[model samples]
Target: MTLEAIFGMASLLAIFSWIALFIFYPSKWIYQTLFSGVLIVLGIMYLFYLFTGIGSLADFNFDSLEQVRTVFSSDEALLAGWIHYLAFDLFVGMWISKDSWEKNISRWVLLPCLLFTFMMGPIGLMLYFIVRAIKTKKLNQSPFH
Candidate 1:
């Protein structure tokens, strides 16, 4: 397969995995099996691209943001960056699902967090923290405590 095709396929797979997780709320199978499997594949692709495809970590000049942009100029390097986002975002989504379930927060609340996590990594995570804080505070204030 071409590099572009591989990138597209991997991206789609990660996206579908996120939707599956949301649709099947609290599903251990989705989080543990499907998501985990996709992450492992993405991780291997990341390493492969890093070592044999475009460039190496040595190419990145930590001293300057401009140098960092220069290093990711290659198609392979860009894909690697994208794959990095996919892996981490999916991992975060899984964590959000598991944590929300454990906290007894409804799936309705988690849906947006999962979607945001997929679309814009840190924003989704930040939203989840807000949700958790509110839920936790309410629990603490219950007169039945």
Candidate 2:
């Protein structure tokens, strides 16, 4: 296959793996392992692309982000990327929301989770953990403890 097609396939696979983890195994060790493995595979594929000089995956110069943005702005790539992003991030948000509910966390905290998924992908997961930690600390500090 052409390099661009290979890269696109690899990207799609990585995204699907992430979605599976989020939908089926969120917060579990198996999920973590699977997600990490997917990332490693993606990294290796990217390295292969870089070494082969077939096409640029990411360029480190000042215009790198703009370059990526431009590529993603195309109709086909944008549609595909948006599909991948929304499917995975929505699952992530749902997982976080479920975790919060399990911990008896207030629903208000979920707003940020939704925002994070829509805007920053995994950053929302990190924010969820941070909020969870804060809530846990408060619980521990309570007189009932």
Candidate 3:
């Protein structure tokens, strides 16, 4: 099998593992570790493919639905990549929404995080961590943990 095919299968397996972790044990350390590790590894592999030109990471050439359909039908690896993209992206959105609601963070701030998460994945998560750190700093100044 080609490197692309192997990577594609790995991506799909990671997504399924994440879904299983969430379903079987909702909010636990193991779930977090598994999900984050899988996501990070898949993301790094995607970047490697993009930079090394082993495979196309984004659909930059397809301009029409017919073209997209043909590509997907002809390319199993591309289909797997699409599945990984959707799975991780939707999970990122859901994570931001759930965490924001639980923390009682303002909806205004959360809305941009949700949008960025959909568009930029880990960048959005990094921004959220920055915001959380700043908030925690300010709160701690007021005699809280």
Q: CA RMSD for every model?
A: 4.2, 7.8, 9.5
Inter-residue clash pairs, candidate 2: none
Candidate 3, residues 1-145: lDDT per residue as tens digits?
A: 7866765677566556545543433255644665577666666665544444423546434689876564455344454455457557756655655565556666667656655665678887777666655655543222123
Candidate 1, residue 135: lDDT: 88
lDDT of each: 0.82, 0.58, 0.57
lDDT of 2 at 105: 74
lDDT of 1 by residue, 1-145 (tens): 7779989998998988888888875776787676568889999988776555455567766578888787677777778888889999998888888888888999999999988999999999989888987988752332122
Candidate 2: Cα lDDT at 131: 84
lDDT of 2 by residue, 43-123 (tens): 555445443442344532246787667655544454445445654665566567557766777766766665676579888
| Number of residue pairs clashing in candidate 1, backbone atoms closer than 3 angstroms, sequence gap of 3 or more or interchain | 0
Error of 2 at 73 (Å): 8.0
Q: TM-score of predicted model 2?
A: 0.44
Ranking by TM-score: 1, 2, 3
TM for every model, in the order presented, reads: 0.87, 0.44, 0.43
Once model 2 is optimally superposed onto the true structure by TM-score, how far is the C-alpha of residue 71 displaced, in angstroms? 8.1
Model 1 weakest 10-residue run by lDDT:
136-145
